[model samples]
Target: MSLIYVLDILGTFAFAISGALVASDKKFDLFGVLIIAFVTAVGGGMLRDVLINAHPINWIGDLNYLFVIFTAVVFTFLFKSKIAHLSKTMFLFDTVGISVFTLLGLEKGLSYDLHPIIALIMGMISAVFGGVLRDVLTNKIPLIFQKEIYASACLAGGITYLILNHFHIPENIIFIISASIIIIIRVIAVKFELELPKIKDDLFTKK
Candidate 1:
């Protein structure tokens, strides 16, 4: 099939594994692990589809998406010990997942004739909200709500993509550039502990 479809599936699988890993860390049972995996795989995309009124949503159309998540869950189960030793590798995979999701989400938004700015937000949401959902389900604060650069990285990538598309860059090249921007941002942020400033809690504290 098309490269976009391939990337989408790859992102789904990556995110599914990420979710399963989180569940494993939390000591969730098998069913709970599977639930978190599926949620993280499609939570963002489903939110985007619903907002944009995409018919039948994404996974509902093919159902093969479910198989992808199932594979991720099984892989996580079989390789739990191995994966535990690959935390850095998993971080890199998470970057790849968000990068692909951001690009695909932006393109999907444009295909629906949405404004570029709105499409950028859509891209950010698609790249981030799944992870947010995963965090929320795990009883942790969402990364985007923290000082993390999670959503910021997606926004930077989306804006670069919009600018490149406006300049008539080749689609393949644009995809590479955009995805690289996202991953680079993520890598730098995580490596350097770069983060947005949090508002001082004393701002509204009672005297």
Candidate 2:
């Protein structure tokens, strides 16, 4: 199998596990957990595929994607206690998922002849909206709606991919660099409590 395909599967698995953990934290039943896991794993990709008119949505096109997500849910069930003991397990998997998804989405968009700017937007959406859906389902605000620098990091990585591609960098190297840029930006932002500047509430009130 191609490296890119493998990475995509890994990202799906990570996202599924992240969603399953969140559902478990909310005391959701098995059916609820499965729904969240499937959505988190492939919701963004399915949206992207629809927007691009790609026939057969990602998970539908490849049964392996469904298998991976199912395996992830089972893994979470079997090792819930052990996984919970790890520091920031959900955060770690979520970060990895976004980083990988961002690049893959960008490439897919380009393959469909989308303009670079639009492709970058597609990449950001693919990396972020699954989490947004997950949060909305759980009655929490999405991270991107907060000052949290989530979609911004995906855009940064997408830009990095474009620039590197322009310079004729090796595809493997570009993939590694772009994915690392997303992960690094996310990790540093969270560690330092960094955020996009917000408008003061007083400004609106005064107006």
For each candidate in turn, the TM-score is 0.91, 0.90
lDDT of each: 0.88, 0.87
Over 1-207, each residue of candidate 2 has an lDDT whose tens digit, in order, gives 297677778788889988898998999999999999998899898889999998888888999988988899999999988886764866776787898888888888999999999888888878887887999999998867877787778888999999999999998999999989998999999999888877677655965
- The ten-residue window of minimal lDDT in model 2 covers 84-93
lDDT by residue (tens digit), candidate 1, 26-75? 99999999999998989998899999998788788779889999999999
Q: What ranges in model 2 sit over 4 Å off?
A: 88-90, 201-207
Best model per TM-score: 1
**TM-score for candidate 2, residues paired by index:** 0.90
Q: In model 1, where do residues sit more than 4 Å from their true spots?
A: 201-207
